[model samples]
Target: MAKEKIVLAYSGGLDTSVILKWLKETYDAEIIAFTADIGQKDELDGLEEKALATGASKIYIDDLRAEFAKDFINPMFQAGALYEGQYLLGTSIARPLIAKRMVEIARAEGATAIAHGATGKGNDQVRFELTAAALAPELSVIAPWRLEQFREEFPGRAEMIAYAEKHNIPVTASAAKPYSTDRNLLHISFESGMLEDPWFDAAADDNKGMYVLSVAPEDAPDQAEYIELEFAAGDCVAINGTKLSPLEVMETLNEIGGKHGIGRVDMVENRFVGMKSRGVYETPGGTILFTAHRKMESLTMDRDVMHLRDSLITKYASLVYNGFWFAPERLAIQALVSESQKNVSGTVRLKLYKGNVMGAGVKSPVSLYNPDIATMEADPTKAYDQGDATGFIRLNALRLKVGSGVEQNAKK
Candidate 1:
């Protein structure tokens, strides 16, 4: 009988490389390595050669850059889904897309199972599995980190390195930099290793190597530059009146924003696994998107509808952060969010200087801001309701007056 086949989400990284070899040895199964290109530039280079050398039967690398930027990143930007109010949902957003592709490969290759290198303690395991469940529940999931035998065989990085050495696996990782990182088009995230310390400052001299997309704000340019973003139905469709695709728009803004040190955030966020992890992120394009989208919403969205959506922003963010992207609740919330953006068509002009992103001006054909109704200029012909002020004030003050009277009566 042919050996059972399993598709593994491979990144050519230390963990996945080791996992690829281990899966072949332990399960005696044909391991097919799969990598998704979500704008990790050179990271995919030689990935096929590395995977085949490390015991993979075949290697598949799918370029999902446009799909990632459009379907995943753009929709999250539209909903303003910031995980824990700080993170741009960079890693979180990429997982579902990667998993979706993994399932597709598994079906195409006639594989019985799909595997990932996500650890049991991290939220990525949940994200990958949840997406798999949503997409293809029939395919079995083989998570090595959660397996007792795998955990006992390779207790930590040291054991994995020893195994690789014994098996002649070519791995470039060493003990010098042990922190784990995930990168994509939207942002780069750094966590674990030296970053595990809660009180440690990410800006310390030792941690300077952590940043990838942006420089320190102190090292930014001295001059400010202005950029205008045009939006239609909450999606950024143009830049300074130049029409561009979703991917192109993001690429343009990333270059413009990174040079000015626009979007760098360091925070200790609550992980879905019930632990707090300190992560430093650089999200230049996403920062510009958030700022510009808010400016558009301010002019277009109604006051009460905006407040209602704002009230649910935290809940929606929590769901995404916790790896519930495919859940029904998230879909319902997304529908409501999309409905609120029907009239959110406008252009937002912003000034970027030394990490500051400020709204310079905003305009829209469907704007609710009326200068005539708000102007203080006197007009005798206008049907002003000055006489209704007495009743309005009395009605509004009734509760406060009743409370005060109750207090007085109690004192007497």
Candidate 2:
């Protein structure tokens, strides 16, 4: 009889590394470690050798950078999906794509189960398992952090470190750091550990070392720089008039925006589990995209159409934040969002200075802005209806006037 095989989403991080070894020992199963490279540039270095040495029967490292930026990041950017008006949904967007690939590998390797290192408390458990369920509900999800036996075996990071040392498993286990971070091409997030104290300012001088993508705003260039972004159907396709691939566009914008310290946000957001958590994020390229896209929409979109989309923006953002990427309601909203972008082709010029992103100008072929009709210069050819103001105002104020008269009569 053969041992059962289990596929694990491995990050080569402390938690996943320990989980890889623990799964092998506890289940006596062949554990295959898989890592997705979604533009975590140097993070993928030596991952294969590390996974193999950590008791993985096989190691799979897939470079999904281009696909991740194009299919996942771009669509969320198009929808302007910001969780709680602060987070750019960077980690939220990457999870489903990674889990999708995990299922594909599970089917390929004939694995009966899949596992992840997401703690029982976090939103990732929902993100990872919901994706797995949507794609392959037949495969069992093995979350060690939620398992009582595993929790008792290794109570915390310190216990996991002890277990790893006893088993001669190589690890960089010291005291865990003061923050937890997740990184992809779109953004980098910092939370947990010392960040649990909501009053403790993340911008304090001591925490400067935590930022990876950009420098402090005070250290940014003194002069403002302007950049032009071209969008096709609400997706940014070019920068400064030069057409580039989706990944290239993001990489280019990140370099330019990071140099100027463009995107940095800190907020306490409501978790899907009914608690609030503080997180700091850096989303340079995404910030630029959001500002430019909204500016273009202002010029190209009709007033009512824009209002309708704006009304649903919060709900759309919430759906992504809550890990309902595959839900029917999300799909329906996304359909309307896509339809609204049909005439959203345009170029927006923006000024980036320090930590600020502002629209410099916007122009679109379908722009509804008409300076001629709005101008103060009198033109007899234009149809003017000044005399209709009396009736318009009287009709609008009828109820108010009637209520005022009734109050006066009572007073008399």
Candidate 3:
């Protein structure tokens, strides 16, 4: 009988490297390693060779950068999907994209199961599994962190390193490094190690090396940088009149925002599995885009529509944060978000200075701000009628007056 083939989401990291080898030894199955390239840049170095050398029958490295930006990141940003009004949903949004491709690859490779290196205590496990269940219910998921055999054999990174050495797998992990990081086009995040302490400052000497995307805010340039962003139906199409692809837009903003020390967030967020985890993130590009997008919407969107979208922002944010990217309710909300963006076309001028993004000005051809009626200067030929205010105020005040009278009667 032929051994069952399994697809593994291989990152070539310490934990994933061991999982690849252990899966082969335990199941006597063929492992097809897969890695999604979502703008990890130099981190993809030597990943293919490393995977094959560590018992992978074959490997697939797919470039999902464009797809990640166009489909996942931008849409969430348009909906203002921020977890707890702080986190950009960086890791949470990427999991579904990774899982979707993993399912497709599993089908092509004739694999029966898909495996991931997410620990049992983390939210990635839930995100990966829920997406798998939603997309391909027939396929089985292998979570090594939840398995006692895997956990007992490799209790921590130290044992994993020992296993790699014994098996002759080339790995660069060590106890000295201590913490873990995840990176993509939108942001880079650091967790565990010294970052596990909520009171520990990430900018301290030992942890300073973790920030790869931006400089310290205090170290930024003294002068503010001004940039203009053009949006069409809520999507940023150009910066400073230069049109670029989705990937280029993110990269450009990252470079520009990093120079000004734009995006840095540190918080303890509630995980879906009933636990809290502290993480430090640098999202230079995303911060600039979020500020500009909100400012643009204020110029072009209707007041009631904006209010309705604001009311649903928290629920929409929760859906993405809680691993429901593939859920039907999320799709439904996204449709509403898309509909609300139909008229959100505008240009917003922003000033970036020392980690702050402020809107200098905003304008749209479809703007509802009527300056004629809003102007305070008196005009002899103005369209205003002062007599109209009497009926308007009287009608609006009638309810308040009746309520006051009722309260007086009750007191008497």
Candidate 4:
């Protein structure tokens, strides 16, 4: 009989590299290592060679940048999904995309099981497992971190390093970095390790090297940079008059926003697994886009529709953060988000200074902001009647007036 095959999500990092070798040894199976290229840039260098040398029978390094930016990042941003109102869902949003493709590779390679390096205590285990469960329930999931046997052998980074040394597996993860990072087109996140302390000042001089995407806001250029973003159906289509694809848009925005020290957030967030974790993130492009998109909606989207979308932001954000990107409720909320964005096409002018993204102007062919109706100086167009305020105010105040009268009667 052929040896049982298992697909492993390998990142060429310490954890996954060790997991690749361990999975092969423990199960005595043919290990197929898979790496998803979701805008890790130069980090993909020599990953194939490393995986093959580390005991992978076969290695698949798939480039999912376009699909990730266009399908995953775009739709999630359209819904304005932010975890804890601070996290841009950078790491959270990329999990489903990575896992979906991993599932495809597993099916194509006829692998019986899919394994990940996420620990049982973290949220990633939930995200990866949920995706696998939703996408390919037939395939079994092997979580090495969750297994007591595996955990016993390697309780922490020190033991993992020894295992790597003994097995001749090369790794970059060391005792030096107790923290971890995850990156994609949307953003890069830093957490764990030295970042666990909520009071830890990640922005201090000692931790200056931690920021990869942006300079410190204080170190930014003195002058503010201005740019215009053009949107189509709620998606950013152009920046500063240059048309760019979804990938290009994110890349360009990251460059511009990073230079201006935009999108740096440090906070302690509640994990889905009932733990509070501290994280530091750099999402330069995403921050700019979020501001521009909301400002554009202020000009184009209907008040009621925008209000309804605003109401769903928390719910949508929670769903994404909790690893339900493939869940039905998320899809339903996305439908509503998409429906409300049909007319959200416009150009927003913004001034980026230090860490601030302020709106300078906004315009759209279908903009609902009527200068004639809103002008305090003149109303020559007769777009809105001043006399209409009498009935409108009275009708709105009727309930308040009635409530006050009821209170007064009770007092009497």
Candidate 5:
């Protein structure tokens, strides 16, 4: 009998590093570590060496930054997907992409199983498994965090560190940091440590150092910065007239938004697994893009169409957060959402000042706002007739009048 070859989604973090050794020891199998580079800044530095030292036979460090932005982030942005109207779903959206790539690598490597470090309680496990099942159902999936053996052997990060020491696995994490962080081009998120307490204020002096993407709002410069964002059919095409790739757009806005102390969110959200969790997110670029995109839509989108699409925001957002990025229903909704963006082409002017995003102006060649019809001033040849309102009001009030009359008669 031969041991199964497994591909592990490796982060080179404490959790994944421990999982790498555990998978090898438990299964006695060949392990190929895969790390997706979705713009985690310096986190990817020395990852290959760390993974190799952690007992991985082979390592795959793939750069998927542009794909992450254009395929995952931009489409979700186009759909205006935000969990609970506050969370930008930054960490949630990245998982499916990572899983997709992991499966692809598994097939190429001729591996029989794929593994992930996501815990049983978290959404990432669902996202990873769902994606792998959807794409490569034939391959076996391994989730070490759920296993009793892994839990008994390494109950917590402290124990994992000890085990790493015993095994001589080089790791950069310490229990002192306490919190867990996930970073990418769109945003950065912190969870499950001091952040576990919903009452924890990230703005506190001691906790302020936890923020990696932006400064505190109170520490931001006093001056206001204004910029123009140009859009083409719901996608941001340029910033202040400089056209850029999706990744470049995100990078530019992240720099500006971070400087202005923008895109910080703290909230307790309902997890798909039927529990509530507190999370702090820094979505600097995404915040700017969402604000600018909405303003652009206001200029170009029809009122009813905008309202209709707005109605689906909650469901669309939930689907993304609940690990249904590749689900059929999400795809159907995305189709409708994409269809609504046909005329969403325009420029939006915004002012960024101390964590605030202010809309300055919005204009579009296909704007539905008609000054001739909407103007309050009296016009001799106006497109709208004031006399027509008499009949319009009567027709609109008729239903209410009938209902009120029926109620009054019923009382008699």
Candidate 6:
């Protein structure tokens, strides 16, 4: 009899540890573990040894940070995709890349099925599975949390810890914290534990130390810091007059934005799984870039083109948030967004003070702000025609005039 090979997304955590052993016992198969290092800054240490000890036949620890920034984060940033205008889609954006690499690994490993640690109730389960379905429909997906048997065996975190201990799997689970977090290059999201209560004062000192990316506004330095951002074709290419790669730009901004206590949001967002979930996000670098990019657009982008792109923001954001990053419609929307940003090249100076981002100045060679045409002073040679407004106003008001007349006649 031939045993099936399964590739599991392992994190060396309690849930994944238990799932690793359980998959082996249940399937009687060869288990291959895969880990994607998308800037989970602290979680990558000693993962390979941990996976093999926990019943995985082998392990794959690939660094996907650079690809994550260039492919996933940049396109989302260019679209200005923010779920509910607050969340930067940090957690949502990272899942696709992770799943993408998993599918590739499955093919190389000759694995018949792929598995993830995402629970059924959250958006991640959909994100991981959707990407797999889009990329490799032939591969089977094993979501343990969604299965009746797996859920019945380990109903909660406590049961999962017990299972890991009984199996002699190395796990770092201890006295559980009130909240859980997911981190990547763009942002870190804290949810579930204490944050489930939307009324909890996250700004209080008790909750202050939970955030990794930014500091509390009140605790930040009183002095304001200025930073200059340069953009090319809608992507930030440099900072403070220095050219940098995409990864370097994010790292630099996270540092500077963290020092000044920027990019912190506490909001209750609508989860794609049809529930209201409260989350506190720290997107310091993303917040700065989003602001600086818009400032750059104001200098070079036309009003109608910008407006058209703006109209697509919410829909585009919804698609990303809902795990459709690989969908045809999302690609179509991105085409429109990319075309709109072709002229959005410039430099914007910003002042970061506490939690606020202020635009200081902007410069662009292709700036559409013609000072001569907008001047209040008289221009004899190319004088602006005030009389042009008469016909322009009349033509635009024609529909309104007819509508008003119809209303008055109906009253009579």
TM-score of each: 0.95, 0.94, 0.95, 0.97, 0.97, 0.97
Backbone clashes in model 6, listed as residue pairs: 178-193
Candidate 6, residues 156-238, lDDT tens digits: the string is 88888888778898887865567888888889888887788888988899878888888888888899999999999988999
Error of 5 at 229 (Å): 0.7
Error of 4 at 305 (Å): 0.6
Please write out the lDDT profile of model 2 over residues 1-412, one tens digit for every residue. 8888999999987889999998998999999999999988888888988899889999889989899988888777767787777888988999988999999999999999999999898889998998899889999999999999999988877888887788667667644467888989888999988889989888778877788888788889999999999988888889999998889988998888888887899999898877888999998988888889989888888789788888887898888777878778888988888888889998999999998998899998888887766667874547556677799999999999999999999999
Clashing pairs in 1: none
In candidate 1, position 124 carries an lDDT of: 92
The 0-to-1 C-alpha lDDT of every candidate, in the order given, reads: 0.88, 0.87, 0.91, 0.91, 0.91, 0.89
- Give the Å shift of residue 380 in candidate 3: 8.6
lDDT of 4 at 145: 91
Candidates 1 and 3 compared: the better one by TM-score is 3
> Which ranges of candidate 4 are over 4 A from the true structure?
none
Q: For every model in order, what is the number of clashing pairs?
A: 0, 0, 0, 2, 0, 1
Name the lDDT value of residue 284 in candidate 6.
94
Encode model 1's per-residue lDDT on 127-168: one tens digit a residue.
999999999999999999999999999887788888888888
- Candidate 6 wrongly placed segments (more than 4 Å): 379-383
lDDT of 3 at 321: 79
Worst 10 residues of 4 by lDDT: 170-179
Number of the candidate with higher TM-score, 3 or 5: 5
lDDT (tens digit, per residue) of candidate 5 on 33-135: 9999998989999999998888999999999999999999989998888888799999999999999999999999889999999999999999898888888
> Which run of 10 residues does model 2 get worst, by summed lDDT?
378-387
Residue 129's lDDT in candidate 1: 92
